[model samples]
Target chain A: MSVSHPPGVHEPGILVLEVPGDLAAIEGVVDHVVEHCAPARLDRRRLLFNFRVGLTEAISNAILYGNAGDPDRRVLLELRAVPGEVRVRVSDQGGGFDPESVPDPRLPENLTLPDGRGVFLMRELMDEVRFNRAGNTVTLILREPGPAGAKIPEAVISTLEDFRTQLGLTLVAWTLAGERRVRVFPGGKVGGADAPEDPRPGSDAHGIAGTRRFRVPVGAGLAVEVEVAGHAAESPVARVLAAAVERSASLAREANRNRAALEAALEANRHIRLDMARERLSREMELAHDLQMKLLPPIPRLARVDAAARVVPAKSVGGDFYQVIQLSGGRVGVMIGDVSGHGFPAALIMALVMSAAAIYAEQGAAPAKVLEYVDRAIGDELESTEMYLSLCYCMLSPGFPDIAYANAGHPHAFVIGAGGEHRRLPATDPPMGIGAAPYGQSRIRWKPGEDLLLLFTDGLSDTLARTRRMSGEQQVLKTVEENRQRPSGEILGRLFELCDRATPSIPSDDRTAIVLRTR
Target chain B: MSFNMRRFGEVTLIEVAGQLIVGNRQELKRMILAEVEAGTRRFVVDFALTGYIDSSGLGILVSLSKKIREVGGRLRLASLNEDLRTLFELTKLDTLFEICSSREEALAE
Candidate 1:
């Protein structure tokens, strides 16, 4: 290994290494070369990435295929690094292969092959890659990205130009550095010209009888001397010209200041508008969240039933809801549903669905009839919005051996036996929007005071499933089964505890679960 | 690389941790192939912990998918971060395998 710089240069811009033709030597050589290029000041991310992956692939290719793994063969690695750019070359002693014949690894047919990816990776990571005629040598290059600046607004420049033209001054000249003369006059044209010697104020110059000079100090060690020639010192026209010249200087300065203030105000206005939009969106979300929470009928007081239900809305309000209604014939109607998407749209649909379901269920309608009426009310709105919801409604009457229920593609409804066994009440129809009228209903054998009715949305299960090895639904069922002997409220609490403990990998959804035990 | 394998009903979930580069990609291939030989027909490769993968690592996945398909098995990828998802899409391999948002959905399918 040898590291050297040009004879007189202080920085090491060149490096050379002799690598043995072995796979084990690749990492060491690549690392050394990468370390050498650190002073080039390339972007840290690209520097670490492009060089590490590109050089590794290049050197490994040189040893394995170029040298054919011969013990005596040697590979040469060279690095030339300068500020904002880097170049690397790797050469082997063996005869070369055809670079054009390498098959693309991304092709579907070749995707399963594992050995043809080195060259492809090098090409992808490096900005440029080239091969020598013999194919035994390859060069890689990377350059620092140039700055991307925003374009200047043309309005400011044009406005200043227009203001200059309005001044209507003639023979206005500025002597910069006491040598270069910039002439601006008559038709708003400006150009450089050789200037005569300085003229004293109030002196006649250029053979004019009453040539008056006024010197205006611009910042930055420069001044503009406005000469009003061919006019008397005290004439009205001469006085007007002098005042215009004086005002032009101060006006120009004030214009610059005003432009800056204008830009700042524009920027601040943009931010204020953005803040107002954000505030409005959050307010609307809060309103929807409040409405959804308030609409949930408190678990209706029942004489022979222990009913408990909870709905945990996500950060963005989701359409998860549960309604427990008291019926006239001493029956309780339990409804749990999950609208497909989130935000105000889902909230609106949820509100409509809850109102419709409540009206029908409170009238002592059967489970199937209640779902039919709710779906009919929201069918057009769901179709227009292209959204759907899964819903399940169950009617439990005391002293009945079976519970009559209607399920619309809601998969979490289950009957848990006192002994910890459970059975699914399968969907009687597709989801509300997609399924047709005359919703089918089903009956499950209910053991009063012994069995527990468990209903939940996908949010509860999805959240629990994120960290657990088992499906989220299974975990919920297991939790319920273990706590079946406890009060329904306690069982619901345990289920929520499991949900709160699991760390969800994805954005959480609204969770709603209902556990009711009828005696 | 670290892998956590758990069975959710019939679907086998494998959680890949850390970078799956050239050095550690073979271990994942061997693990999945062995499971396939053991008659595990459904699989979900969860990438919630994985941060990076090189081309060679992708090659092993492709080959493993091919091998799994020969035995009438299915492979699904879940929880890929934005960069990893872009890699699969760029390689056009996202179309070859089932890509799901969450492991729950993947296992259910």
Candidate 2:
């Protein structure tokens, strides 16, 4: 449908554009308004173009950043058309910002930062502005016809003059369309309002990082407030502009929230579709995880051997894994892997690596050959998919006392004897994903009753403390040496405990570890 | 060392809190300067309350101390927190000023 403007509109044309508070809808509104106005009004010298850009900005900002993409907010837009002017008012349903306290985005260093430019841009675009007390409603005025002149209302002028005695120096400027210029003139400071404090030279007031007020004269005898307060300009002006801005924001938010509630209510029946999608994904992940987990043998029910394993995926699904398999030939195969990063993709890659390792192991492949196959398969897949995984695999012979293993970017495995002698089985190759590194194996014969073998992902040793000084493999060895007297499971647990104690609050990568000991 | 305060008359303690970060630091500096110009320099700053501080806060604090000292008075800080006190010790301001356990102790010193 075409936009309809009523008759009797004067020199400046005013059109109101309304859109939902959703980011997509607000953006559509911006495009629609810009498309309608930019071309047609090129010839019009004095036109009043107003619609709720500021309000839309506030509501959409709340939708995108504040609520973090929650679809429950409703926004309303009200457009008022006057002679040579258009005012767009947007109100949101969400809680509003405190106008006096927004962080300054225009500070010298903040000019290039990614945040805090929205309000400043909004203020620059509108000719005259008003903000509500709660900082929700914002009224933005645009003069399509360009500014007519300093038309500050006599009442406001007089009020300002009454308060001018309080300010030592008041500089006012007209912030016209497409400009950021403030000039010093012959006029003295107007007196009226109570002065908070006179900013001294070399003080924050004198710097380019604080607030300064100015006046803009729009067409048809309307003079709007302009602030050039250095860095503080955005917040206090946003406060004054909040009256108009907040209303628009409130209206927009209310509309969006109501829309969301309706959609959510409808979702009671509609959730079948979402559930269907979720179930499909869950099915794939469950199958993948099950298959991968099966490759890991359940605890060998041997009374003599002390063995345990743990894996915590960083997501609903994860790439970091630990597995122990009871081979058909009466041997045990143990492996640990870390996919390049945490996510479903990584989990998927890890699953592939696990399957390849299992297939190789089932064929009676040696520790080195199994790793070579897994690495080749994983490296090929990573190359094809542009992703990578780190893997470590081991084969334990009942006849041979030492554990045999190969590391592909995985940390070294630790071995602790019953009497506290500790040693690390070091791998001789780079990570599997590097493509060119050939997997190599190392074997150590176990001493009679060498009771504990620890296999772990890097998560245990890769902590903030070890991040700079040494590699996780080195830390693992150090920790193992320190805790050699502990049981295999206890050693792994204590290693993680030590790292956790060092950097308690740091968000760590996923952690996984497996312990196997000859009885 | 990071934050210092002194009493001019009685009961007017000027305490500085947090890092007076760059760009916005002039405000804090001016506040102190204004009070100094107004001749109300008597201050008992509890630095123990400050968790962190930066160069600007340090510059302002030192400048205020110098300003007050030139005016025949001083600024004293009480109950310095561990980190700030460590910073003071590192900066060697621990020797330039009196160290006290509490605001009352600083006042007495």
Candidate 3:
């Protein structure tokens, strides 16, 4: 079905065409319209047609015939005028396929495939084929010629409309005058001398050409002798032609103004969207940081034990942890861990290790037993995951005077005491989560005036030059020896400060230290 | 951080000359793994020039060291920077394998 044009009026109007079920018929009708209407409005074009309804058929046919016309399938099409281009969209309602997976149809075997050519042809015809929502929605864009055909300003369009209406009324009066004179002087056609022949057709009651012809009365007289013989009035269809030319000028001005306004609006919208995205990202980052911070334990005050511990995180959220917890039976459970990596994953692993330690420590088991339990608890989870944590757990008691600790793939702990010597503790077992290795607690002895017991992470020692020389041990001992006279907190601070001085801005993991001064 | 590579036959000695941080780990891993795959398994990493080793970078080294050991080859480390040497000593990783005083000693071992 199609809407036809009204009679005798020289104004453009939209035509709507609808086709049902038949894909072939749809293409035929669209092709015919393009051929006929394109030329008619090719010059001095003032026609706009909207096809809101038939988009389904047009798109489906493109998918079916163009894409082998598979009958069970459906597609969608949309055509709209954007700022600089005319956009046509054709989206297939098929199981969405990756755009990258579609091989070039120009290849021999691919040429025969029914599904591929549709997209290729559409791509050739359209300026761009943008896929939205993982290839579910596709848009085809086409640009019009000459700056979207010049916008006529609203003020100019209104003025031109009023002038044309007045001119049309005057022309109607002239037509009536010519008809009356012809009827009254019917016999005088033979007697009166013939005036200069009016070359215009009889329908042209007022000879206004295709250009706007300004006619002004030169002298005051009963019959105004206005000169209309110049440039504008010389055309055959002068009156209507004059109105069209004036309308075109106004249109050009209006289109420019509209384009300018539309561009400004688009720019404003882009800025607003960008600002909103930045704000959302900032909020998400803050939340992640807060969650990481909450996962850490509060600094434990070991007043009875005379222990001073300090942890300095490299980033806003780091993976290092050092805690001294009061266990059952008047024993103290001391833990120091370095989760495998940094940032969010490391933070999460640290949290997990802390929770697991808390639960296992409640059992009042031996240090080796606690580690074995922790290994099993995080077994498959840590093995399959990319990030993991390394931990050290020690249970110190008054009866033992020394401590029994288990190391699961972490840097060894230290004892700085009366002997004025610093010694590295042994790892009794392999790192946690690497298929369980046996963990046995080793005993340590301390005498009176045993100044300090230091447990730390690797961040303090692993500098590039030191890592290469394998001299981190020597450096750490030297730093400890130099700062032995300082307070426990100052000693820990000096250790990190020494690390920083050695490496400058380079970070060596997360700095964690727990020092106990024997009173 | 700057990375320096010295190829001695198939044994590639990588001397990392700067601070080792989290951001450069991926690039470091890519280079090291690519070398490993190219049949240069006998490696002597000279961290003497490196100023620091973060947890992320250390993890990469540990994983790489295990990978090399699995393939019937060894990753010998020598001349650790001041801070890193302390980490190795504190971690007791200094005792787990052969740690030499210089690149020549590491290669000789």
Candidate 4:
């Protein structure tokens, strides 16, 4: 059905929300209604809660059963408010059904079914509920505390009426105008100037003889004053009325303070929500970091090679990985690689490369062929992420005097000879995913017992430069040359010590290092 | 890092200083992208004073280089200190763009 807006009817508090028929949109609608009630003078806790639940049920029914989850269909929620009452109408664009035909959901047989209960709950909870003639629209009306638009609360009026009946008070009323006093009770005015301008709770003579008067401040210039025509100022009935006026004023002051406190608490809740989101992000980063650390292979004690590797993650996860695989031919495969980028996305790509590299190296594939296999495996992933991985792999056989290696654009792979002479491995091919050119293998001389091989990622270079103010590659060469005769484990441990010394107070980028000493 | 741009003949020289990482890298991307969109494409990025750069920063430079190249323009890198050179080499990014030893070398070409 086509919707229409009748002009010239200016509602005091009107809200209209048009939402697609989706259950996921329920929370947003509920929050909107709850917030709308605060300014509509339905801020009392009980009234707000009842209105929220009632509205939720009404909207959910309209969206679920009435609209049947159709995206093309719409649910209309309109809230029209007077001073003390809110009339809500939720209508759905669907074929109508008879309200009388709906089975009673509270009966024993139908109580277990979820589909038939929302309308029953909405009717029972709200002050008044009715379905339109088409049965596709639900109207819910709720009246908050106090009579419809009554200035003084219903309780205050009833209390004063009790006083009037017990001792026949002639006038009892309130006015918010601070500087001037106008009589506004008993449906008319009977003024005798203002109440004595005293902010205390006591009585004095009204304009009429034998009548008593009392007024008390109700916060921000509003006051409640009572006048009894037949009672004297100090009489028992006048004293009772005086106590009741004081009680009403005190309640008003408490209510104002509570409203302020509620506002403060709401602001605090908003900040807490923001802090929670930040904390959750940090926690996720840490989890990704730990996952990357766990992916590094533990160094195994082979017959002739002592191997060690270390990866230090930054405050956020970084994309660096290393693996030491003992192959089938008494030959060992050692690899160090870095994926471009940081954080979870980079770390995830690093993990994929690590697993693919391990599987290829385990099959005793040549270093060049291993890189080719890995490149083909993650080719699409690298292209999609706009990133690549640089790798340096070496296959060392204990009996052979040469190490067969492949360089895939990794710059920090080093080979130290027996006399402490260092050889910098050059890039044989571009980094993975950058060039389709094939990987190339080369051979470098090494002393089985006295020489060591060292490989590193760029974070090591950045770390040394940031902390030691020294050349990154040079510092690493000096460390390796000095400890050439040491076992691979000790050299790797010492390198980690240096890294800790460099960044003592803060976590640095992911720094990976591998030292291989073949005896 | 902050960028200071100047014109040298047909080329736009963007001199960058300070550390380049994820947070401030977008500013560099915005400045270069704005220029590239305005049809000024012959560019040289001088990183002599740049102390550090992270993966995100590197990613932007790589994407920017490709963008400039796709527009039928050439982008060059000049005056990279040893540290940045090592970074480029490690990631094998040194092959992606033309590198010159100094800004004077870049201008001469």
In angstroms, the error of model 2 at A57 is 20
Worst 10 residues of 2 chain A by lDDT: A177-186
Query: Against the correct fold, how does model 1 do in TM-score?
Result: 0.44
| Descending-DockQ candidate ranking | 1, 2, 3, 4
Chain B TM-scores per candidate, in order, are 0.95, 0.73, 0.89, 0.93
Give model 1's DockQ, 2 decimals: 0.14
Candidate 3 lDDT, A193-305, residue by residue in tens: 23222233333323333433332111111011112233245545444434553455456546766876675566456445534543443354346457766666765665446
Ranking by lDDT: 1, 4, 3, 2
Off by over 4 Å in 4: A1-271, B1-109
Q: Which stretches of candidate 1 lie over 4 Å from their true place?
A: A1-272, A504-507, B1-109
Docking class of 2: incorrect
**Which tens-of-lDDT digit does each residue in A59-126 have in candidate 4?**
76776678876644567776777666778878777776687787775455643332454555465546
Q: After superposition, how far is residue A232 of candidate 3 from its true place, in Å?
A: 67
Which is the leading candidate under DockQ? Answer: 1
CA shift at B4, candidate 2, in angstroms?
Answer: 52
* TM-scores of the models, in the order given: 0.44, 0.38, 0.40, 0.44
Summarize candidate 2's per-residue lDDT along A112-161 as a digit string, tens digits: 33345445534543555555544555556665432222223333333333
Give the per-residue lDDT digits (tens) of candidate 3, residues B1-109: 4678889876889888864444455667788888888888788888888755543455566667777888888888889855466545433455555677899888883
The segments of candidate 3 whose C-alpha lies over 4 angstroms from its true place after superposition are: A1-283, A435-438, A463-473, A500-508, B1-109
Q: Which stretches of candidate 2 lie over 4 Å from their true place?
A: A1-297, A302-305, A328-330, A417-421, A462-508, B1-109
